[model samples]
Target: MLISFAMRRILLPVLITTGLAALLMAAACSTAPQPLEKKSEPTFDEGEYGGEPLPGTEQVTIVEPSPGGDRFALIRRRTPGEPSDPRFQLWIVDRDGSNPRLISVNTHDVAWHPSGDRAVVTVAIGIDFYVYTIDLETMETTQWTGKESQRLSFPVVSMAGWFRDGHRLLVFANQKAYQQPFPRGLYVIDTRDSMTTGPLVKLFSTTCLGNQDRYTVGKKYVRSDDPSSGNFARYDFDDESWRWITDFPKDSLRFVQKPVPSPTSDLIIQARETGNAKQLFLMNHRGKDVRQITEFGGDIPVWSSDGSYVTFRRDVHRGEGARYVPFKFNLKTRKAEPLWPVSPDSVPDFPDLSTQTLDKLKPRR
Candidate 1:
């Protein structure tokens, strides 16, 4: 089942508006504006927001760690203010909380290449969203998709993950409003084959594992809108088939999301709701040896490079809104702890690269 979280819904609309404004301004100007004599790197004032800050919280969702585990990519958001326009920013930082650099501005989702030399980012350009590959070494970006990915209305494109061979990407696209004839589903794009363009080849209608090309996981829905009758199933890419894995009681309302496999093992972690709230569960590749790993509620679980631990966000309800706190769980010890110590005064410093900096580090074509 595709669970639309509150954060995604809140950020997409705001960023799409900003993208549309940019497009309008570009179209209105007949002549290109003169280049600025001095273009400094973009920077944010530390003390710009001087008053009592808004009650809402800031969060960092870990996308993926580098193959070496020395660096990781994440999306950071600070809501309840105008400066928060463009909703989210993609950041890359060291494991020790050092050398934090802002790679993409106003991007919601990111997927790292297995080689750790580049990352694919999803950003709104106007009424449509597209994916671009950013070179981590030179900080140069290349738009990977074009007219083929566009929809009649709001088209949302998400970078699921890279294929095991790192030659193709698993992408998911759907119109904000469904169109009967238009197709909406998961697809795999050949990263190396530039001649092959347009909406990628649709593989299935639900989510799947990134690196494992052989098997894809999604819900088997009996009805169009109802999920209570659904059961988890795995799709075989080789044979082009799906096999049911789990079937809960029909009377119970169960929802599943983010069924990710461990980096080094056959273990898989997923979130499901069989009770009041969604909780994390651990199971083998075949969906056996099912075990509950979290009780206080968590979602979007990502495994470390070593696959020894999993990190997820825990939602805490405040007065009007909610705050997502990050936590890490150890598989061996079966213990959970706060990912980072709480600091009321701490503010993250996001790195900004100047045009000159990017030009100096531009990758060779």
Candidate 2:
């Protein structure tokens, strides 16, 4: 289940529909054939980013932007027409939806630094997943983890959240390779040392869940979204356990699910069931002043780097088929426009641009 969650995370974010329609659409999307664009080399400049601010929130930072929050999750067969496991071919675009670039192929998971230039990416070799850091400017990939033995190694590593310091990672991994390799749980890894030889400390021993599992990785709590509803809980790293969420404004959120706190941590975007349809909404942290954002579909809504915009998926049905589209909604204007180079008419559609800053979603403590 957790491994499937990791695959879901690579697909980025999307809200599950209710009932049979939801299951059917999910099945359709899962089986839908995606077009494979010609791959491109990295085109980032060295001077594109610098200087970082502290991200907000306790488990996540609502203030600092998450660069990893912007990658579109996708499945691209490295060896076309061959039966194999699903591999991600990630596409990245600017917040305005311009400058679409194929970041990497055959990747597993990704976690970006607050700087929006560097990424901690995971990839599967044969049986185990390896961690690597990508410097967009220099276009270099560095191995972050290695193994000496099967029992003393992390067979699975998914970068879940980052600390405010930006050098520590809240990662999901399993120490040993087993016939059943569901991740052991969450652990802290410091990148201060060379990543390939970093330290690891266990945090919990439950079914380790991350953003890939459709849970919003927060500072004090991990908000897991149920297609039917949502739950807020606190993840106590110090105690190595989790507790129920406290001080939340859940006064009128009886029908909310897939709730994503913005990078600022002041507002949350959620899906509310209404008129037999699920639509997107934006409300305050207190859960007051609720307002509708999407009239129809708001699949996997995520905040942009600066938190001024909300990126969402729009499913367009034409004739007998439907295509999922990516759109950026302006908070100030209260209007949503399609991200550039992608539209309802575009073939094979596009991937999500922003998946939420796991670091930024940490509640302020």
Candidate 3:
């Protein structure tokens, strides 16, 4: 029995050691499968409703917010399923309680010009571009016809301030500026000479090396994709130079919206993150200061006229999963509060609007 016990101990140790060695060899020989490559596609943005109006104050969509002045545009889809065309009508509302007025009776993809003198609008049916100029004093509408091309999905003109001469208009179309799918270049057009009857001339194309397609217009500068840091850049179309404007982290940079250039052109605001952890960055082109005005978790950040405030949509995290909540961020206080009283269940989409024309949208039905 003593001999048997001694033999058993010796055999067990040898067997365990042998088994472990074999397992190690097998693991070393096996190869791990590589992870699948990811698809890079822009996610749809969430929607942010405006603040509560005064007692008996009509509900309006806040378009842009500044220190004391805010511009809001109300848009209503033509009665859904109604006999009338299934298009969105436009209206403009002043921050001060003023009745909304019509801008485009039938138009989508509205783009404002750099001079703030007119808006480039594309109607349903025809792909031609039409300019809608509003008289600030009398509120009269003047329509100008622009050059025809396969119009961009979301086209924007350089703001009045961004141009060196204050007269040139830069239009960016989603028609392959550098590569296919995304906008690759910008077409400069001189609208000051247009009489709405003759053929419009095409200006030189603005090009960027990397997917630097998405951008917003400013005075003598176009704030676009830095692509290097996944942040924003202010491009000088005339001098053919680029300057980095914002310093959003790479992770947050992925979620920033296709920046909305303000009327002044120097300032821009965009969504810089996604889901229930979204944030908005107010950036200045001349200075390197980036302020995080809103920490609301959502997407889409649009700046106001005065560049003091911004409106954006955020998400509300519910532990395991998350829900989207709209919000507004004040730049001065750095307060990011929920804008919506009741959250929206449906996924939101914040379409691009021309600041000049946005003031003219009707409410959605």
Q: Which ten residues in a row have the lowest lDDT in candidate 1?
A: 356-365
- TM-scores, all models, native as reference: 0.66, 0.52, 0.47
Q: Estimate every model's Cα lDDT from 0 to 1.
A: 0.56, 0.43, 0.38
Candidate 1: where are CA atoms >4 Å away?
1-56, 79-84, 125-127, 149-156, 176-182, 195-212, 219-231, 248-255, 274-276, 316-321, 342-365
Ranking by lDDT: 1, 2, 3
Off by over 4 Å in 3: 1-62, 65-71, 74-85, 96-98, 105-168, 176-184, 195-232, 243-255, 261-267, 275-278, 283-292, 313-328, 336-365
lDDT of 3 at 257: 51
The alpha-carbon root-mean-square deviation between model 3 and the true structure, to one decimal in Å, is 19.5
The clash count of every prediction, one per candidate, is 0, 21, 36
TM-score of model 1 vs. true structure: 0.66
Clashes of 1: 0
Q: How do the residues 182-237 of candidate 2 rate in per-residue lDDT, one tens digit apiece?
A: 33445555677643322223322222222222223332322222221223443434
- Tens-place lDDT digits, model 3, residues 249-298: 44343334545554433545554443324445444434334444443343
Error of model 1, residue 299, in angstroms: 1.6
Give the deviation of candidate 1 from the true structure as CA RMSD.
17.0
Error of 1 at 177 (Å): 6.8
Candidate RMSDs in Å, in order, are: 17.0, 16.6, 19.5
